[model samples]
Target: MSEQESQFLLILFGGIFFAFLMSLFVVAMVILHRQRQVKNRQKLEQIKSEYEKTLLNVENEIHQETLAQIGRELHDNIGQLLSLTKLSLNSAKPEKQQQAKEYVNQVIKEVRALSKTLNLDWVESLSLDEFINQQLHRIQATGFCETSLQSDHSFAELKKEEKLVLIRVIQECLNNAIKHADPSRIDIRIHQNGKVRILQIADDGRGFDTSQKSSGSGMYNLGKRMETIGGKFQLSSIVGKGTVVNLELPFSV
Candidate 1:
């Protein structure tokens, strides 16, 4: 072969080899990007699954609590009313019969009100402020402790799941206070702060130390529930002074 021809052939082969290497590198990069995308998608799916499970659990707990309340009302309130009604009816006086008829009417009204609470539809329709006010009133009615609610009337526009979770958290806090704290007064405040909605539940009860680890996982679970809904739960307590639970929720501007 001639020297010039040999030189040209060598350069041609070298160029071909370089092109092959570049093609391989591009293929490798594409594969890596696809793998990363798949991983991220899987992680997102896992997070969504966990959030859904938490939401279902919160709903069930609230339902059970409602059922319990209904049972108590039926047994304690309605049952007594019925007994009084029977006694009044048996009396010979015409006025006593009239009073018995009134008792029957009251029982009907109480029943209809209780029936309204039997379904989960209220979770979607009830505003956070309204629910908090209702809870406070219920406690006050019990005469166990004085209760009050203060709100600017501005409220969070929350999804049904978010509202449900938030309601359960508040119920748990109130139950804890009444069951353990022996507080004379319980107060709840709801308002907006910039892009955040805030709820503060404060009680003049026997507070416990937040530093000490609790035997039950109630506090930790409450915190996790708030986190799932993109909110924060903070609790502060003193030995004898009082306890306060603060919840902050962020909203889009």
Candidate 2:
């Protein structure tokens, strides 16, 4: 080849190599940028998890405080009124006794209605079975669906916070089952084996494609609530088999 031609070819090869190095450098920078973004997202998730833990703690304290206040009110005002009405009835004359008895009876009825204050502090004194039973009763009172809870005696030994989360999670499960599944029968089962607590809610209804429906806030919240307490949440459903929400909590309160 001629000297000038050889020189031109060398320069062309050098330019191509430089362009190749530039492209490699650009690709490396892009990859580094993506890694940084992923790291930031992980850090944000950690912060969010910590925040939710603190928030749940605060809410629990508030709920306990409110329950105490309500219990005091029921014992003080309602209890005193019922006592005073009973004493007044005891002193009334025979001619006036029937009228007095009716008034006292009405007052006693009001006091009993007010006594549902047990709901306010239910978690403090009741086992998980009782807590969930009361909630299921409330749901049944709506007459919208048939709800049942089956639990082991060991369920009451669960940590109060864990029990609270499970209770709320079950409610959300039932809500979804009713709203999305259009279920006629909703069943919740909870049992403890040693330190592990397993909970499941299932329904017989039109099932859904869970792969396409994983972004629901109710499902996300239940999962997050379980994670906060070191529990695992899982969901599975087939187009015709119906949905099952499963949870396992291994630690004690």
lDDT to native, each model: 0.92, 0.73
Backbone clash tally (model 1): 0
Top lDDT: which candidate number?
1
Candidate 2 lDDT tens digits, 1-253: 9999999999999999999999999999999999999999999999888857755764565466446646765687667766766766777577456656766777677666556553546556667677667656766776867889887765556666666676666666766777888777778898777878788888877888877856548677667778877888998888867888888888564
Q: Which stretches of candidate 2 lie over 4 Å from their true place?
A: 1-120, 193-195, 213-215
User: Number of clashing residue pairs in every model?
Assistant: 0, 1
For candidate 2, the lDDT comes to: 0.73
Q: Estimate, for each residue in 7-52, the C-alpha lDDT of model 1 and write its tens digit.
A: 9999999899999999999999999999999999999999999999
Q: Which stretch of 10 consecutive residues in model 2 shows the poorest summed lDDT?
A: 114-123
Pick out the ten consecutive residues of candidate 1 with the lowest summed lDDT. Answer: 152-161
RMSD of each: 1.7, 9.7
